[model samples]
Target chain A: MTETHWAYAERMDAAGLRDLMLAYGQDVWNLAFILTRSRDLADDVSQDVFLKAYRTIGTFRGGSSIRTWLLAIARNTSLNAKRTAFMRRTILMGRVADSRSSPSAEQEALARRVSDEIWMQVLAIPYKLRETLILQAKYEMSIREIAELLGISEGTVKSRLARARRRMMDAREEVEQDA
Target chain B: MPDREPEWYRRLRGNPLQEPGFTEEQMDRIERLAGERSGASRRRTESRNVRRSSGMEREGGERSEMGRSRNETNGPAANETESATGDRVGESHGYGESRRGKWSGGMEPVAGSGDKVRTGAGDGRTGRRPRRIRLRAAAAIALASVLLALGVWRFGSGGADPAAPGPSATQTVPGGGTATTPVQTPTPQSRLGEPIAVLQLKGMLAEQLPFSAEDVTGFEIYAARSTQALTVPKERTYVLLQNLYNLDLKAAGMTGVGPDHYLGSSESATLRIQTKTKSYTLDYDLATNTYGAFGGTVFRFYADDQVWLLMQGLLNAGSIWAEYDRLSEQSRIEAETRSNADEPVSKAYSPERLQVAGSDYNGWEKQFLPLSSGIRINDSYMGTSSLIQQLGNDEPEVLRVGNAIVFATDANKTSDGVGVGLTRDEVIRKLGEPNVKTNTRWDYRIGDYLKFHLLFEDDKVRFMTLTMPF
Candidate 1:
């Protein structure tokens, strides 16, 4: 196996980046699919993500692995894209709600339980916490890799995930109590 | 809570994550991207492979087996990996991907924060925005509980833990298993004599010198045997002394101290602290063709390679000029070869004299041992060391001889310690000197600095060296 960026995240020309992305395309796409739950979102975000990585790789100081850097970019871009879409929909809905005076009960219920609610919640946490959690759940990365990828103390990562778990537990307990 | 941490860690021992969707295509893609990002660096890997394959073709293509042989030559023995200095030991398996399967306690570090992120509830999206993010945070916590339960269940079922880190993460340096090291202990001969004493005396000199040498210290003379094959007759020793003393009087850097009645000249050259110093003297005795040649008494008042590096360190590092370059570590054998190059002199003859030994491959080969110690080294850059041994020891004193020059070392183990690089001129001037001297090169060993009569033709100080580490 060959490692390219031991020194730092050096910049790549477009064609070269294309080859690298193609090599890691499935991994990146799969990651995007899980994050966005949309094939179109995964594609658009992936292409955009690689270009962004290409543009800024020069600034990468190499404190972390290249995969971590790329994944971090993909994660952030997808989240922002999701946010922008939600905003656009919000604007559209406000207009529709104002025109109709009130949304129907079924429509309100459907709006509350969007098709990707579970995924949306999973993506909602802070980056540090979410990354560790996802690697454990999806990529099945060990604590060592998670620590290496993010440049965090392994102890810190563990506690952060532990906190995340506790937070989820409390959240569930509250919801159940309410129910 | 801290103690409880270990229990959570214990779970990692039982439940290992299945391999992710890493495939050959993925690895290839990564390799290509690495290439595009690093043109030559990536190219070097493939080229090296190609070079290896092509190298095999030249030898009838028994390449795979030959490759291992060549690779072994690069990192000769497993023992070579024990470097005295511990800096370069790092990860193994130079793969390009970042995310990997869980190693320690089955927790993969999150890849660095990327472009994907969640938005605040009030960031313009209408219905998708929950009134409070606290709800989303709660959902995340819920996900964690479920995963934990799953991990625990897996653990209970005797599945391998995804978190336990490999030995690489947990091992210590002594057993870290790197492939090349220079952690050799010197022999008792090194501990017994002037080298050890000089090492101790170096501390005192270090207090005097203003600077220090980088990396090299604790030099031990591996051997100090005498050789007798090259000894000139006693009468010739007197004649040689006369010629050398005359040469010193005419040397450009010399300044006479007393009247010409003493019939000798003194050479003086300024020295940079921790750098090479340039000066000494010579005297002639008319009765015999004997000239007592004495000059170039270098004294580095510093510790270690400060003086030596000062003299020879700037000779184009990474250039072919270097005695040793720091690039190959893939194997053990190559490191051994490189180590030999770094040393100026290696062998010490068992007896003081020999008629013949070693081949005359590059430079002069001499029978060495007994009265004079010799070192044969390739005088030019990129050249191999041939021989350097004393030819004779009529007096049985261990002296250094090389090229066509010869000199004796005068080190002292005082209360301050074993002092190396003390001036012979100062010693002779105070002691009223030798009844005879050799007309050999005006040589000096001042600390780590070693200078010989490099300019027999230039009656001036053309052979001055100022790079001793003191």
Candidate 2:
């Protein structure tokens, strides 16, 4: 109903969708980039988020700001994509190593792969533990803030954090021993 | 691990958790998405509140109809939502695979929500079964993979000029947030101004004969019957005619209206009755008596607590309807007399004549008819008035069948008006217009007559007929 500007509605269009994809696309790709460790997978996830958001925007009912609603969609889409990728890989290529086949010399790809391997170990932990570790490791989000975001008891946050760290440490030891 | 936390855990507490996978572009998409969703939610909430506050007026007899009109306007907005979902699915169709991820694990629940009206109605048709929804889901997965590879091409490429809006008003959302473009007007009629003319059907109600929804032919038969009955007695005619209109609605099972006397069953039922009237509006309540009066005076039998009060409760809609017929007959007579008195024709064209035109053109009124050969040519057209009985007047130029009149010329083409004398042949060759006739009985444009009737034989002027002047 903004007579002067329908900027938000326009953004829902293809060009607007593209303008948006281009403008803040890197954040989405980076999120996808980190989760999949494959640039292509990251790009795919970024586009999916927009596609879903564009489709469902009509039902948004605008209770909160559009930015907030979109972020929620982003979070949901990312988590779902990550889980599906995990299942498909597990199903098709039984517990494949996170290590790249080529192990190319480029530092960035290496950095991404090594981080992804660590994250894969992180994902192996239980939901409670994984949740705490992701907030701490990936987001650098403080425990208090993470507690607020997840709407959990801070005590639960504290306990989960303790368990996640132990898991990470155990995972590091196993890798080291194997090496 | 330590008591509260291991030292490494403590270090982690302050550490900025690396956001595992979101790239800058991903964040932007999320931001814009949130903006749009919020905007839609706000609009819906505002309208809901508006409807709530308007409830009292919405139910009011007159206001309820207006509310229905407004609801019809909201249909386009629903279509907009459908298309948006369609485009989204089409985009997903390109993603093919590699969509598996942690969050994807539970999405079976979210996708279960029935949002797939897109594929069913996205192409502008509606109604797809749940099967279609599942089918779309499969297509989306494949399409998603395709779009992913194309995504690099899409995002890696530079942004050029924005895509121009589609050729439709809703190249985006169905009706809202769209712009209009001009279309060319191709004809002189288009330039003539407001070519879209309507005879104001609602207002035309009281102004027409048998002003009801009954087809013209059936009603004409009824009107002829009623006109025959009109001479019976004024009071009885009133009782019969009104019953006709009332029975028409009653048979249709319509009720509920502005009041007890004012009623309609549903909007559709109301429209059926209303189509006969000049206008369809919330103001219909005032029209019950007002519209009928304009057509002519009423001959309705008096309604009193004695007869009306008793039957008013019993389906004495019969009485009201009978009264409509009586009043309608009275209205018809008054209009005929007034019409006949004005120019010259004695009455509205007989229902038998009207039966021929096939069009519902009701108001072809009487005017000063220029008669010759008794031929009525394009009575609806301008500048000529004449009527022909049988193409060639053979029988004694008098119509002896009913209350009819005949006037003919005495001289054969006198020089009085037509510059020279002539036989029927010469008359047709020169003054082919109705005013010139063969017999002297044809007066030149009867100074103050209503029309001239020309009687012809073998397509040649045989005699002249004229409407006697007062």
True-vs-predicted CA distance for residue B424, candidate 1, Å: 70
Full-model lDDT for every candidate: 0.27, 0.29
For residues B1-470, write the lDDT of model 2, one tens digit per residue.
Answer: 33554433444332122443444544553444434443544543343344345331111011111111112223311111211111222111111111110111111101112222111101112212211111001100011112222212322323222122223221211101121221221111111111112232221121222332221011100010011100112112112222222121111111222122222111110010111112211100111211111112221111111111112211222332222222222322332122111322222222222111221111111211222222111110011112322221342322110001221223223222322224555654554433222222222232212133343334433333322210
lDDT of 1 by residue, B1-470 (tens): 33444322233222121233234453443333333333433433443354344331111111111112111222221011111111100110001000000010111111111211112122221112222111001100011112233223422423333322112111111111211111222112111111111222211222222212111111111111110001121111211211111121111122222122211112211111111111111221111111122221322111111111111112122221111111111111121122211322212212111101221111112223232322222111111122223222343112221222222222212222212243445333322222111121122222111211111112221121111110
lDDT of 1 by residue, A1-179 (tens): 12356235466664656555655555665565445444445544554455445555676666556666666556544543332233322321121222122223423443344433333434433334545666555555667777655434577568767855554444445546978
Q: Which one is best on lDDT?
A: 2
Error of 2 at A69 (Å): 5.3
DockQ of each: 0.01, 0.03
Against the true chain A, what TM-score does chain A of candidate 2 give? 0.51
